[model samples]
Target: MRDTMKPCQHTLSDDVVYKDVVVVGNGPSGMVTSFVLAGNVPYLKDIPEDLPIDEMLRARLSNLPPGQSLYDADLLELAEGLEGRSQNPISLLMDNLLRPCADLGIQADSLIEWRYDVEKEIDHVVLGRGPPGGAWHTFPPQVRTLSPGAWLSLPPHTTDSAERLTASAVAEYCRRYVQACHLQRYFRCNVVVTSVTAAPPGTGAPCSPACPRSASYCVSGYDHKEGRGFRYACRRVVIAAGACDRPNVLPEHISHHALHQLAALEKAAQLNQQHPKSQSRCWWWVRGVSAADAVRLARASGLHVYHLHRTAADSLAKLPLLNYPDYNQVYKMMCDGASGNYTNYKSLPEHMIVEVTPLLSPQTTNTEEENKIRLKKVKLLNLVTNKTVELTVYIVAVLIGSKPDLFFLQTNFDLNTIEIKKCKCNEKKIDEKQCFLRNHWHYLKSVLGQSIQSCKSRYLNYTEINGNIDTKCALPDCNKRDTCTCNTKAERGLAVRECKCEIIPYSNLRREKNCQCQPTNPYSSGLGYGIDPKKPVDGRSNPVAIDKSTHEMFNFPGMYALGPLTADNFIRFIPGGALALVTHIHREMKSE
Candidate 1:
């Protein structure tokens, strides 16, 4: 409710609101419901194939017009355009948006390509992961997870809540097959949502409040000079708001991470000096480390200082995910635990309740550009009993959730209405002994070894762990305490995983000092620093806004991500509170 934040439209009204069903977000879940209903229902017939969808990435339409042919043709072209390229589009259209509406009996127009602008359109910027930074949608977090469903958020919860799975598919369907399709009917491009008022019935037009109904969708309106504002009002609103469409909002605790690492490194130094040179080999042999991975490593090592067994990718570099320290340690930990009985399901530890899937994310997913991965919930499968149970997730689905004016009958003020708090992602622990943020470059330097250098004097430094780090250390805390997130500058934040408000830290083998602080981006623009550098800046080495990781989007046979994105039996996603939603539609005849 700060002036800096935009007023969300999903707030609750004073009246006791009632409807057939009040689906909050317009993302996959809501869209599937509506795409299933749209023209099939008795009243709203001839529903245009051109349902207005938000642009997932900045893209452009070569030719814009009306009707199904153009849409389909353009979509084909777009898909073909992306044939060999591997990048995650901001929005992914689902086939459910095109599925035959069970009631109205109309075939939905599923997206098959990138329909919206890739580089031109501007999304209303907000953190879609972590939590609901003040948003509302059709389903609650619980309903989403239990159904084996998926979602995405930037900062965490945008409980103006909703679904992501189906819609993401449709976004792709349209983009790949509906390019010049007939989108002229349902909406106007660039109509960013500006305001929403869910007052009592008869509050305005028939589509307005007095009716006590909500809107289907409200996006930025359009104007020639200044862009138009948002729109509202829809009977039986089929919201498309999802939890995975928010922007990046990095944690502001680089400092805390440093200190945590410093403590961890100090212990490692003791081990390095005592251990033999052969034992001083780098941590795991994995090659690339992503921002999300670092964060994950940090979370798992909270309090208990967990060391990086090595640095490398789970696949290409020859390291196995199951064999990695974090993976093996967790697997070992899972092995020791007894098979969880169904009768005692409610008492499961928070971590075992996780379920994972391939979906977009909001964390520092910047490192593996060619390896764009999507996340779903983590499910706990009892290795002993072969029984699989759904685990709640702490997801950062905000990036995929926030959109304007869907499920607008409420304004979040009504206390009786379910209070949708902005769930935040987790952050790091600032323990005095190990300040990773203070020694980020130091630890990194240690890991990188010859490939990297160390931070200057007074700054933190990274050193090799040797065999000493792999085993135990002599630190007072190490002797007395359990674990921690070592040199990896990963920490907890506003949203732990899915939007649960809890700031905690992960254990990365809590270290003492050192890192890769040798200036990755120290070049001064248009000046002396550019004299010696010869690398092209168009981004051979520079950071590209869009990640170009492998074609890990659709799970096509030779194209699935080597790891992370794959949900094949071995994965698990966990969270706090999640549920499954069941919907049934009934048609109302106008003649009545």
Candidate 2:
């Protein structure tokens, strides 16, 4: 007799408010956005038929100046032509909810404070440190107006509004706490982070020192009134907080490799000249391939070679290339980039890893016969044992690294040895499991590292990243760390350990995880290897989540205003036949 399982227990609706707009970040963008939207809101429709009489009364009452009253204010409304709309229709009904509420009162004051310090420096020195005669603002502190002079001068996306989504359980002392007391009077609400780890350029922080909206904000945790923080809702949330608004930093050891890659990129860029998007045609995708393979591929006609993790995919995603990285379409051999002779981030055996050397060439350019051939790897020195270890070069290389979660090793274990686990494609000949583990592990450390398993487990956060792997993933449950599902045994010849939550190998990544603390993978959702990896995960659901799938801003309307259009990006970037190819591919996919 089969036992019946219980019915699905439904949950209650959270106390969460369905905001008309819940802007994630509270940086210059969020704040000024809220201010412009709320305080000086423009009317949605033209003049609202009722305005003429109101204007007339105000004009009659104010003989001296129509500007003195509300009617004198310039009417604000949607421009005659709003831009950046897609084929799919979206809501004409968006609720006007104010994000980053008024806890930012001192935010205005701190900006004023910082500005005063600079202006007074030269004058104070001229006076020999004597008390200044007057202050910078021509009027008294009480005079609040959006006139020629005001605190709302900074552009959005640059300064910190200081208010942010405080994840539950983890109290945020960085901004909210700073905004609490006397500190607000002296300092800005949210502090901006200026380093690569915190806020990178094109983020909340501008690279230029003299950027109109340049300033650092604070980031840290503190005690709250106990509980009460982030509430997980069914709808979507955003993460456009600020540059200083990052989750965590990578460990010092892992981060240096990215810096090395950046240095190489700089040199490469210099060698190719600034307009090298053309000559820099070598599409090197370093994932789980060997150095021999890398050299082989690099020497090939089209593609270049590099290692995963070392390439810095996620971090660089925040840069200009994410918009249209010509590298994406180049034949990419997807693999984890880990020198797994001995380390973590190893890909499993059962998972499909197609091996073949990939073809690479100047993207979007017609290739000549001379530019289309593959290369083979030559024997390389095995320094560890001084033996020759040969590696083969194949199409598109991927780095394979391992990230062993205690969550896995802790819960499901019956092992005493450092055994390599593998899935049997057939289980007829090769000792794939033991062979793989023995080839790429430090038995001593795996055993030794278990000394500290007593630490309390907080929560888990697995943010699903984007395909480009440039920007940070949206926080899953901000308060929690990342906890992934790891299967203990290989059931039916399939290794259950392999999942997106596992190690993410990328040609480039600013970071794979956020919190460096153990027992939890900080940025666990692993860098988005490609667009919505879930499509690869689940059989159903389209990979591309049409605009309606998300509540966040898709693209900027005035992108054309920022930079001049180049033929490479504006038109030629797409492979000549990609559009037709994409259509055909989509049709095939739908049929399948």
Candidate 3:
């Protein structure tokens, strides 16, 4: 019955806008994606002398016709055949093409040059919350990027220097890049994407210019500047929206004085203006050794910061002192408390913030300044020592971590949900029911065609990975009916259980139910190793499962993920994901 279902013939509404592509961010990744989709193509130039690029890969590029583009070639065939450390070969190839030998300090000139081709340009729109820079403009004034200014450039526009840049400088640079690349027309600022779902099957009537034969997605959102809602029907949706909008907050209910790390420094500055030269007390809750900008700015704002973090001293000691001088200097200050060059700072390592209580002191005057100093008693628990201490502060800054707000994606659709109609048979006899269901699963697989069989036949071997035995499946999702389990390993005395389900093939529709099972496996969607990209674990090296050649999410055609969501965290490597997406998209458009 599932195989007999026909495609829907619903027509699009007149209010829907049509485009070849819709990019969901305006950050560096989104900017790069837009730059390429806007018709800027990269071609190989004269290979530089004495760079650290791979020899075989360089030979391949050198062999290309001088005017021909590396992008025009089969990037999958070129990149996949070569050996590399990265699981994604195309990402590695693009990175090498953009910045060869960057880590080794050579900073070699880019091997490719971009040229705009009118024929290759596709109709697209960029939706973002702010002007071209995205969230960078919202950072604290004193905040500086972890990457050097030169590393943050979108192609064809380079920064003046390689020095570490301030937040405003980077934000302004990003803004100027849009103008420099002539991409201002394609960007829609102050727009919040509220929902993204598969467009109804037969929405072809209202398509503008021309209708697309490929899969189309519906993107609806609110426009803050226009004070109205907008919708778009696009052939592809690129999720370059980075993972910094929503902060990972503390468990406690936030009080009036508490602020996120990004806004805390600005609030501190405002307090400084209200009470000049006053020694304001602050309690800073941070995780790991990052967040140097907020910590430094908090001290510079005439606030005595009681720094609480979960990082071990040994971790700080392992940092390369020369490369990370700012962080190392912070560690040095931690070592040298209340002494030369570092004052009004205290480091409490291995401590967890237990509770926060707002205290009302005796009011001497009814001034705004008097109310601002209402104390917050922060209770701390030392993880190593199990000792508790309480301290009073004027304000609290929670600077732990952050993730992208992907609620729009979740609300509109379930990424991993698959529809599987329950099999009806007598279930009183357990053994007979198991036999009947197993046979029913085979019947479903047969209906799914040879494509499903080809996928499952390749990876039937049990292999050991990092001391744990699991199925070695190349595809994230497979039709294997095997129950994967491990109990009482001799070496570790640990039990591991990974439930693998027999997935039934059907039309890729959103908001469907999975097979009747206990605790459905997150990996059933074909995402990376069971990692949910929408709400990824903080600091975990979890990349979404994407086609190495195209950067498209597995099982979800016409959808791509870029930037930190793709697990390419550093700005220097993010553009690689953008390049992969554009190459695939451009090829698809050309084929059509």
Across residues 303-373, which tens digit of lDDT does each residue of candidate 3 receive? 77777766634545666776568777777766654343557678877777788777876476655434545
Per-residue lDDT for 252-348 in model 2, tens only?
2222112112222333333333443423343223322122223332433233343323332432233233432322212121223232331212222
Model 1 RMSD to the real structure?
23.8
Q: Model 1, 562: alpha-carbon shift in Å? A: 31
- Model 1 lDDT per residue over 492-549, tens place: 1000112212222324554222111111111111001111122211111121121122
Count clashes in each candidate, considering only residues at least 3 apart in sequence or on different chains. Answer: 267, 57, 0
Ranking 1 against 3 by TM-score, winner: 3
lDDT of all the models against the reference?
Answer: 0.24, 0.22, 0.62
lDDT, model 1: 0.24
What order do you get sorting by TM-score, best first?
Answer: 3, 1, 2
Top of the candidates by TM-score:
3
Kindly report which residue stretches of model 1 are placed more than 4 angstroms away from their true locations once superposed.
1-26, 40-171, 177-184, 187-195, 199-226, 245-586, 589-592
Task: Report the Cα lDDT for residue 66, model 1.
Answer: 34
* Model 3: lDDT to the true structure: 0.62
